[model samples]
Target: MASKKRIGLYFGTFNPIHIGHLTIANYMVEFSDLDEVWMVVTPHNPHKKKSTLLDDHHRLAMVRIALEDYPKLKASNIEFGLEQPNYTVNTLILLEEKHPDFDFCLIMGEDNLKSFHKWKNYEVILERYSLYVYPRVSQGTIETQFNNHPHIHKVNAPIMELSSTFIRKSIQEGKNIRPMLPETVWKYIDEMNFYK
Candidate 1:
């Protein structure tokens, strides 16, 4: 009798899942029509190098810790079981089969949007799901490319210029990363000695 929750799939490596990532997901849940936002952690990106990535399980754990306070936010390890060189199209299709009752949308930063055309099965992705894009500290090239797509909507989230790469670098250098992530997440990272 209860209605299924509308889920937004926010796929990313999440390398560390910092405050900036949380801010965008929170904004989407609060401001958009979606009922929840799932941080889908990708094991590996075909386009990105895996050399700089932290362990997938560790990254997922950090995401869980970061989102513990928000009941509507969840961290998913769906890609963990999938074969590597993770592709968004495949992940979306699998999620569709597994969670049939929930409505799904794709969430990404403007930077991803710009390079989305180069993604595998990009056309299928565009046709099947709506895209919710949050601005990042990058040139406005992505916005321009998809300006005509009716399914794409721009989100007005806080401009947090921080990044996972920055956090990782800070940790490697033995600098404090508390200011860049949520308190609970920072605690986990510190306790586990992640990125060190």
Candidate 2:
């Protein structure tokens, strides 16, 4: 029998999908055992305000365009159709139901892992899925329980300090932050006058 495909689900709002996002996704798929990395464009994040987010389709489009050249990378709008205020655990359950042949894993930053214990059903998630964590510059220390956990793998990928909020603010302030984004994505954002 053929082995199940290992897919890494990198969840994000992807307000505009900058180079940092692409770099991490590319690195995960290429350097790790993951067969593909899906840039899961979240439509609504329960913690963030909705007013600041662009339309769901717009964000998904940007992710799609940014990943055009990377065959191992893919854009997924899986959360777009899900109910609002969705949790990661719920999404994982749904994904498993929909694609049983694919073994899904979560790709997150060290900052997020620090608060993983607070997530709903986090223990259940750890039991079923593996987590691939990348380094990030953020406050707070990781929980002692997660230290050397068998399911958690910390990758030594480049630390990307860029943020979508910074990109948006730069555009609104009339700064030329073109190099921070993929060329096609920059063009799309410029043409649409987004975040202006």
Candidate 3:
């Protein structure tokens, strides 16, 4: 019998999938024990305001484009069909039940680790899945606090200060956003006039 592949679930709105997103995903696969990383595109994040979201399909498409060159990375729209205001715990539960063969881990930035306790059913998450946390700028305090969690693993990747919000703002302001995202993703965003 063959062993099941280890999968990491990287959930995000990915409002516009940028190079930073791809870089971290690639880093996880290249440097960690996980065999593949799925960029789980959430339809809507419970913690974020809806007004800030781009269309889920568009965001998912951007993720696909951004990861096109990396065969180990995939874009998942699993939450698109689920109910709105998606929670990580619920997604984890569903994926676990649906695919029991693969070991699952949650990939996140240290910034998210700070307010993790406020997330719905966070304790359950901590108990069930391992967390791969990457360091981020301005993440000093939160990273220190989560260092004690049994399931938590720290990852070091080049810190790209770019963010979706900054990309969106650049687009809206008619500034060039080509440098912030992957080439394919930038082309797709330009063709679709996304964030404009």
Candidate 4:
């Protein structure tokens, strides 16, 4: 029998889809056992203010354009249709029901790992699916319980310190941030005069 396709869900606001995000998603699909990586554009992150986000359609459009060249990486607007302030648990449930043939995993950075326990039904998530974590330059130590856990795979990927916030600030400051974003994405943002 054919094995279920493995997919890593990398959730983010992606206010602007920059090269750092592309690099991480690309690395996960290339260096790991997962078949593909989906960049899930969150409509609203509970931790962030709504005013700070770009319009949902704009953010999703940026992701779509940024991933045009990467076949193994896809832009997912799955959460766009979901209820506002949706939790990861709810998304996982829906995804499982919708794609019975795919084995989904969570793709996160080392920083988020420290706060994993605080997420809604995080334990249930760990019990059911694997977490493919990438390196990040973040404060705080990981919980001891996550140490050597089979479900949590700490991949030796490069540490990406670039952030959407930084990019946005640079653009607002009239800095040349084009190199930080995908060429196509940069063009889209420039054409739209986003963050200016």
Q: Score each candidate by Cα lDDT.
A: 0.85, 0.94, 0.84, 0.92
Which model is ahead, 1 or 4, in terms of TM-score?
A: 4
Q: Cα lDDT of model 1 overall?
A: 0.85
Clashing pairs in 1: none
The superposed Cα distance between candidate 2 and the true structure at residue 43, in angstroms, equals 0.5
Error of 3 at 104 (Å): 0.7
lDDT of 4 by residue, 1-196 (tens): 9999999999999989888999999999999999999999988655566676889889999999888888999999889888767999999999999999999999999999999989999999999999999988888999998989999998888888899999999999999988899999899889989887
Off by over 4 Å in 3: 1-3, 45-52, 143-145
Write model 3 residue lDDT over 46-133, tens digit each, in one string: 5577786877778888898788789999999878777766678888888888898988999988788887888999888888889998
Q: Could you arrange the candidates by lDDT from highest to lowest?
A: 2, 4, 1, 3
**Which model is ahead, 1 or 2, in terms of lDDT?**
2
lDDT of 2 by residue, 98-155 (tens): 9999999999999999999999999999999999999999999999999999999998
Residue 33 miss distance in model 2 (angstroms): 0.8
Q: What ranges in model 2 sit over 4 Å off?
A: 45-49
Cα-based RMSD of candidate 1 = 2.4
Model 1 stretches astray by more than 4 angstroms: 1-4, 45-50, 143-145
Model 2 pairs whose backbones collide: none
Q: What is the lDDT of residue 171 in candidate 3?
A: 94
Worst 10 residues of 3 by lDDT: 138-147
Candidate 2, residue 137: Cα displacement in angstroms equals: 0.9
Error of 4 at 55 (Å): 0.6
Q: Tell me how far candidate 4 lies from the true structure as C-alpha RMSD in angstroms.
A: 1.4
Candidate 4 residues lying further than 4 Å off, grouped into runs, are 45-49
